[model samples]
Target: MKEKDGISECPEQQVILYVEKEDGKYEAMQTGSYISANYLDDYFLKRGTLEKALGEKIARGEINAIEYYMILEDLTISELAARAGIMKWTVRRHLKPGNFSNISESALKKYSIVFNITVKEIVTRQSGNRN
Candidate 1:
């Protein structure tokens, strides 16, 4: 892959991983979450770590630079809604900022199970700036 800056440009065949951000940093994330890359700072707690890692990788040319692509592989709202057995509107509501707070633990658990990803990955804490 062609490296640029410090972000990986995922290949067409590769799935774009989603990470959560909290408190102005990047956090790990589980699948099926609605967090968007555009709001990475808001949902991710480990931005420093991610940036550092990507920077090193970019310097070595191990991966391409990061850029947003129109295509993504993560589940859509409708797909998540189907798995949750809820209406699409419910999924949309859960993805909303204020509405996300209302999602029940049980619902989150079910979503995690269906997506086969860990809650920790979904909600990662920010790592310290030790690099």
Candidate 2:
């Protein structure tokens, strides 16, 4: 992006951007994130809707904490399995409400680590504790 075209809609949230400067040189510039500035509200709106739907599913016992955290983290089964060092099939099993009970404590710890959450949070599904 050109230096003059750099979006500064959010002064509090500055990001380093490589912008085209005058005299035809590229230079590092401080600017607000284009997507964040332009689309943050829409992102939040969609996120709220998803959260509400997921919360309803959780309340209905159609899914478990494992699945809740997984969806909220935007992780695929294979990606979560890789991060937690668990088998993909096992991760899939844990995503089910009934099958989550069969998971071992060590496995739960692995998932908690992957989610950056406490094991208790994984057990309870009380989310929004990202560090």
C-alpha lDDT of all candidate models, in order? 0.44, 0.81
lDDT of 2 by residue, 65-129 (tens): 78887898899999999999998988888887777668899999999999898898776663332
Consecutive 10-residue window with the lowest summed lDDT within model 2: 122-131
Candidate 1 lDDT by residue in tens digits, 1-131: 11122234333223334443545454443332223434456635565566667545434444322100000124666776787676787666665533433667776666656556554433321112111
The Cα error of candidate 2 at residue 2, in Å, is: 3.4
lDDT of candidate model 2 versus the reference:
0.81
Using all chains and alpha carbons, the TM-scores for the candidates as numbered come to 0.37, 0.81
Give the least accurate 10-residue stretch of model 1, judged by summed lDDT. 64-73
With a 3 Å backbone cut-off (N, CA, C), the pairs that clash in candidate 2 are none
TM match of model 1 to true structure:
0.37
lDDT of 1 at 87: 78
